[model samples]
Target: MRFQWLLIIPFFCLLTACSSSQVHWRDISSNAVQASAAEEPLSLCRELYKDEAQIYQCEVEMSALLRARQQCEKDTDPSYCVLMAEYTWRHYKDHVLEDSPDIKQAGNYPVMCGYKENQITPCSLTK
Candidate 1:
């Protein structure tokens, strides 16, 4: 009986050690904001695989990205279209930042994805 108890204790300890260690998204985002408030550098370790979309600005950007990707899904090669659209968006964001540093935007909506326009001009040259 004592031997069985010893075996179970070690087995439980091993199970606990092997548990998944996924970080909470809120922890990442909340910490970034908190760090900013404290005038501290972000405490997150990217090595832990934090989701970029968790950041407030990133969350905003993701809305546009997801919208663009969803619209692109109608294309014959949806996945490819989405990939290209994302690439274009990143470049477009960089372009806008270079041209108008004051513009706070989450990339222009993908016109190539058949999106006519967002009321928010974002970084598009049309504005």
Candidate 2:
């Protein structure tokens, strides 16, 4: 009985550790752009303009996109994760920020992916 209990304790500890380390979508995306100075970083600007309806729509779309990406990755397809992430970022840039020309233009300008102060239009330009 004592031995069985000891075995269960290790299993439970392992389960807790695994759950604690499970990275979420927000964390993954934040990590992806950890050093980016891109306009509307982490989709934060949406909150500033969201009316109730707009807020709901944004919430649903963003949540679905993140969940889909996370689920796809969990299914062992990292390509799907990458695709969904890019899709989500573009959606925000095109639809949500479209009304704000300034934001749109900022997004159009190039920004660094993993470094601060490297976000300049010419820096992002590709020949």
Candidate 3:
């Protein structure tokens, strides 16, 4: 029984060691995603509209995009930031008129943390 317990302890220890690899996976994948996710929103007005009326219309839509850009900056997650920014811009262009719906200032910011030694460290995990 004593020998069996000794073996069992090492087996359990190995299990924990293997689980630590999950952390590396998370760090790499999230970082990779974050790196790949960076993209600026498509300009609401591809080129400057020469006419005053056209420029004003373009600016209105641009406001939504600007708000989306601001919201994207607040998140640490790359994919989510892209999704929210793109969604707000697309939604505003498709549904809302001018600046009716402020989709930019929505959604909660979630935090992801890592451990060192025995302490928890707060981190920006994006989305």
Tens-place lDDT per residue, model 2, 1-127, is: 7799989999999899765532233434543333234453335425432455444344333443343443344333345444544554556557766452232343342221212223322222312
Per-candidate TM equals: 0.38, 0.27, 0.32
State the local distance difference test value for candidate 2: 0.42
* Model 2 lDDT at residue 118: 39
TM-score comparison, 2 vs 3, better candidate: 3
Give one clash count per candidate, in the order shown.
Answer: 0, 0, 3
The Cα local distance difference test for each model comes to 0.46, 0.42, 0.41
Candidate 3 structure quality by residue, lDDT tens digits, 11-38:
9999998654221112223333332344
Best by TM-score: 1
Clashing pairs in 2: none
Positional deviation of 79 in candidate 1, in angstroms?
0.6
Q: Order the numbered candidates by TM-score, best leading.
A: 1, 3, 2
Candidate 1 off by > 4 Å = 1-54, 98-108, 111-127
User: What's the residue-level lDDT of 77 in candidate 1?
Assistant: 55
Error at 86, model 3, angstroms = 2.7
